[model samples]
Target: MTVDCAVIQRETPAPERPHRRTEGPVRTCVGCRKRELAVDLLRVVAVSNGNGHCALTVDQAGNLPGRGAWLHPDDRCLQAAFRRRAFGRALRITGSPDTSAVVEYVRAQTGAD
Candidate 1:
């Protein structure tokens, strides 16, 4: 007489776990074209000058009512943006945006902090 033994294998279900949030909101820098957290970048909005021309102004508080563009607040990025004419395309403006105010704001903020 002969005897045989058999073994069975089965997989147990994984325990249910709560989903964890990984990343926060991210935005691309129009100047450097780098992806970064929205909080880390400065937001700019397009404003009309009442003369059929549009300009960009920095929204330090991140609460403006128009289309917003993101920047790094760095001199190199600012210069690259201007050189590439990214503001007009980003804001969909037909005229050159007055970036003096934005530049001054960034300079002051960077200097202070």
Candidate 2:
């Protein structure tokens, strides 16, 4: 008499494991267009500079109201974003918003002039 092992295995249930949370929120860099952890990228937002003009500001703490864009803290990424105008589009602003603040922040962070 031969017992069917396949039948016995099919009747057994597999153990379930709990889902594990390992990483924080992931964001895409508007400059390099690469996915990265939110903690690794700088958050940027557009705000009025009191002259009815919108300007880009770096959210160092990553907690600011309004649409936010992510970017790598590198000079290459900064230049790429400027060349492609990714900042204005990502922040949903009309015309070229002032980027002096953002540029300075990146320079300071990267130690670049």
* Model 1 regions more than 4 Å off: 1-23
Clashing pairs in 1: none
Q: Can you tell me which runs of candidate 2 are displaced by over 4 Å?
A: 1-22
lDDT of each: 0.84, 0.89
Best by TM-score: 2
28, model 1: CA deviation in Å? 0.6
Q: Candidate 2: worst 10 consecutive residues by lDDT?
A: 4-13
Residue lDDT tens for model 1, 14-36: 99999644477888898899988
Could you say which candidate leads in lDDT?
A: 2
Candidate 1, residue 85: CA error in Å? 0.5
